[model samples]
Target: MISLEQKHHSLLQEAKRRTQPDIANLRLCFELLALTAAIDRDCAVRLAPHNLSEGKFVVLFLLHGQPHGLSPHELADRAGVTRPTITGLLDGLERDGFLARHSNLQDRRKVSIRLSEKGDATARTLFADHTQWIGTLFGGFSSEERIQFSALLQRVWRNTDAGKMASPAIAGET
Candidate 1:
């Protein structure tokens, strides 16, 4: 595994060699990418035992909170995936009896996605475990440190114009 120090050293060298403008900002972005990758891996590890993937878990988590269900387009927007990709994710969940697809009476072409009874229970169980895992993961940080870290991350998100651009579909996200 590449440690943060090694990553920083490599990025610093690249920046110096290229004489990159905004070296400090570039370095900060690299570090943040590394940190994000680490967190994503951890989340995946925690979700795997529950037979959940990051994408699936995110979909279910969103569905769990909305009893009325969400349209596929809405799920695509909220889950940060393309519409076809959302279909595949929802397909497996539905096949396993974790979700349901409802056609709009007014427009048969329109469909809403919802968690089924089994899916809801399964997701709830996984969520409890995942929540505990997250708590443990961040346990090293004191309350103040956690606050500061969250603030820093939020600032980075704002600085990066995260989701500020048009929808990923419009942006040609695949």
Candidate 2:
């Protein structure tokens, strides 16, 4: 009775032998991971002047377009981080006057987060031409290539648990 780990190792070895796995698949995987890391680093650098980290900026971005304020748990879900992490981000934002937290009037037990006036202004300043920044990253790709790439990315995303983790509801929260 082979263990699961042993079976997986056997399969991987077989794949490497049969495919000579140092080819397109492996190279593409490495390139994609490197590109993602570079993008994240660039975003962090661009946001540093505003005293915001990438995670905090993501929370602000999500709240920017929504009329309904999000609870910390909801923000955590959308940001794909733990509730405690979101709490820390919210605390820092609140202290910096970028956002405010209020107890839900109808349910005093729940706390909702909303952007302060300062936060709104800061977001506007920081996000100017943000879409153009993203466009620059893919500028070399043709329109058809962009569509195909996007569809491929969507397929990969859907096949992973990462997509499920970003659902509107809090993870493991009733």
TM-score of each: 0.68, 0.68
What are the per-residue Cα lDDT tens digits for candidate 1 across 71-150?
98899899999989998989878887889998989999988899999889888888898888878878889989988887
Lowest summed lDDT window (length 10), candidate 1: 165-174
lDDT by residue (tens digit), candidate 2, 18-65 = 977555554455556666877888888888888899888888887785
Clashing pairs in 2: none
**lDDT, model 1, position 71:** 97
Summing lDDT over every window of 10 consecutive residues in candidate 2, give the lowest-scoring window: 1-10
Total backbone collisions, model 2: 0
Best by TM-score: 2
